[model samples]
Target chain A: MNVPLLNVSGATRRFGGLVAVNEVSFEIGPGQVCGLIGPNGAGKSTMFDLITGVRPLSSGSIHFMGRDVTQEPAHSRSPMGMSRTFQIVRLFPGMSVLENVLMGFQPKFPDGVIRSLFGIGRLGGQERDARQRAYEILDFVGLADRAGDRIDELTLGQLRLVDIGRAMAASPRFLMLDEPAAGLNDAETNNLAEMLARLKADGLSMLLVEHDIDFIMNACDKIVVMDRGTKIADDIPARVRTNDAVIAAYIGKRAHDAQH
Target chain B: MPLATKRASVWPVVAVLALGVALPFLLSGGFQLRIAMLIWIFAILSMGFNLLYGYTGQISMGQQGFYAVGAYAFALLQIKLGLSPVLAFAGAVAICAVLGLIVAYPLLRLRTHYLAMATLGFGLILNGVANRWIDFTGGTAGLTVPPLTWGGEALGRTGIYYVVLAIAGVVFLLHDFIARSHVGRALQAIRDDETAAAALGVPVRRYKLRIFVLAAAIAAVAGCCFSVVSLRVDPSLGEFHILVSMLTIAVVGGLGTRFGPLIGAAIVTILPQLLLQFGAAETLIYGAFIVLFLLFIPHGLAGLVENVRWTRKSAAPARTAATNVLEVKG
Candidate 1:
């Protein structure tokens, strides 16, 4: 009976003759962790692109917090409390971890570029505040000790945490993570799942596109399964796990591959 | 955590300031002072260039267009419009900033090489227009700017040099402030990964446009200083050679480092003057230095300092890991 935090209806993205995402519809409710699972090239990332306004929707619409945001640009979406991380970790490689996270506090710069140029705005107080917030987020993501290290010095798992830390610095109400568990060891994956659960407990909504089956199965409140740009299943994880279409789309292929 | 390290940066600022103050008096010779002044102006130019290329990672081969606009605006505003030299300088920078903003809308859409070429095209058009507009630009013969005067007394050579020095000092401080501020971090973030910056709410396109305009405005300020120093405005200020030289200064000094542009500017400005005795061989040697810097020390001289610091810091971690062994030995 409540408006979803993020709603997509018949969202489609076409690349020339190929339909990357075709008439896909889903909704992620407030404080809910919705898992988007699909085989490779099932338009999972493309769906994120449409949601974040990184790519224009060929058809249909996306509404965030019950308002139409399909026409907005990607940068504008963040101020509205929508932040995301890339499938491949996208930390600012040249910057220290603190500096990278500090960049996420951009919305707090109310005076914009003009006042900033004259040295009137963000002189000391705002910078200190941002730095404090950056460290806090780093601390939250277990990267507080490594805040001074350059991104290049970080291991892949540490870099992934840094990405999440930067995203978290934006203080988003809804976070979209594209394959956050990829390339992470089992312990790191569990660590991420625990972090996501804690974020959820704090009433943050999340849309996670991941291939880590056990991680998603254990963590997500609901799971939406996509196959070839179409939604095959959307329900609570317990029911969705038993659905025939979901099983055929997932385990059936694995079983067939096992035969080979 | 590194409060002691923070204090280290202050010494360099003090040293540069002391050097800036003492240079004019120490030089004494007019030609040497002229070279110093030129170095200051080009340093300002390269600082602007670094803001765009070094921090934001956007290359503009069309900076000379903005430079020429500044120089000509200063000269023409004084000569034709009868404005004061100082007022003309301000007006020129303002005009260039506005022009930069106007150009950014269409220009910033092109990424990397295309953006560079688009800017180059803009500069070439400016050059052609300056050459053809005889009535306005004096058709390559150029316009002579009246000596900067206040209360009917000319600034003369030394006064003009000091005026430039003061302005250049302000620009340096402003550049340093931006480099250390949240703005500098934002620009560097955009350079590192634009999409990620946007996702973090950096207003990527807007910041890009602003930096482009800001860089142009600074270049215009440098051009205004050049006009005052040379007292001449010519189409050559907007030529391809000026763009290449400015790019060279930015690269050779070290992209993005605080004092790299200033050091690069000094080397670039002094090198040709020193090589005057060697005729055209000066250009050959200049080109060779650039090649060598690019090949061996790609981060420029600033990068060399970073490497030294890195090596020193790198030793500490090794010692920390071997602390148990040291304890046993002790």
Candidate 2:
């Protein structure tokens, strides 16, 4: 009954002659928490890159909120309510944690150099608003207390949350997280799952790419399994778990496994 | 209390500016004033370098090329065209900024060490041009400018010192503002993680080119001032002499920290003259000090200050566990 928030049709990426992602198609509806699971070299991260404008698609159509954004630059797409985090945490190590989040708010600031320099007109107000929002996002992610600390001081798990807070600071309608639970412990993983659920409740759409099966199973409403850059299965979690292609892809019983 | 903190951060700058104003009187010699003026000029150049290298994380070896362009631009305008010093300085800055945009377009594409090498090659080309263009640059012999004067009075060594001091103060304030502004944050983001910053919607290449041009323009301003003070400009200004490009004043003082370049400039500029006071062994001692500084304190004196702050803060926790526990509980 709801319009899809993100629509990817016949997305194909080729690195030289080798096809990395081949005609993959999927749709993510509004407020949907979708899971994308694939083994190493399954082109999941590359797909995130393509969707976020980090990599130019060889051939594809990516529509966000019914608008074609296939050729938009990363910065432009960010303000259109699309934001993503890296597989490896990429906080500004030299800057304070709050400032790292503030970096994500770059798009909301006045783009005029004169306004930025003179701190006049709309820019000053935007800066104050951005700072307030950054702090609030940090608070939401339970990182308000650590805002003043340098990013390098935080542990890997804390840094992951900081990365999420940074994406949230952009006020994105859809958040793409790549391996958000990659380096976290059990307790931290559980906390992250809870946080993702809370964010979903707040009407935020999420595309989660993670290796932790249990975490994904608990958090995602629907699952899209990728194997060798192809969509192996797409269904609700209960149906996807019993799908043969998904099973073979995860358990290494596929013809594609022999080529590697 | 926050205002008090802000005031505390500002006082050091006020004190340093005051010291700069009083330096000529304290030294009281023509040679000393000359050396001080050179230090101030180089300090400005180092600050420009700091913006590109320290803050933006772009290693630029072509700064010397820009410096020569500025120096020659100022020199020719003053000597041949008989332009006023202020007009010549402005023309020099304008030309350098244009050159910066031209060079940065291609050079910004080169990554890391390759970028450094590309800029180095560009510097060499500029140096060669200066040497070969005999009529304009005076070849290896160089060109000279008439002494700078204001209000129908020639600026003596002491007067030049004050002028240099004033220029340095303005440049320092400009640098401070740029460093604290959104532009500074964007530059730092580009340095920290270019891909991530780009993903967050930073116009990485545009910001990089902007800073590159800004740095060049600032260097041109400094170069113009240096040419006027020395009354001479040479092809050596563009020579790409590794040491001149590697003048680690910013690194030796503190990269990315305000006033660090001045400290670096003072050490590099003043040390040789002080060594001159000691006769021929000065060069040997100078080289040794540089080697030692590079090896032992790579972060420069600024790092040492940071180290001291770190130790003091680290030590406080050990001595006040009870207070810390109470605060944590509260």
Best by lDDT: 1
Q: Which residue window of length 10 is worst by lDDT in model 1 chain A?
A: A251-260
Point to the candidate with the largest DockQ. Answer: 1
Predicted structure 1: clash tally: 0
Off by over 4 Å in 2: A1-3, A111-115, A120-132, A254-260, B1-11, B240-246, B306-330
- Angstrom error of the Cα, residue A199, model 2: value is 1.2
- Which TM-score value belongs to model 2? 0.89
What are the DockQ scores of the candidates, in order?
A: 0.29, 0.26
In model 1, what lDDT does residue A197 have? 88
Per-residue lDDT tens digits for candidate 2, residues B120-162, read 8878888899999998789999987889777788878887778
Model 2: how far residue B176 lies from native, Å: 1.1
Residue A215, candidate 2: Cα error in Å is 1.3
Interface RMSD of 2: 6.4
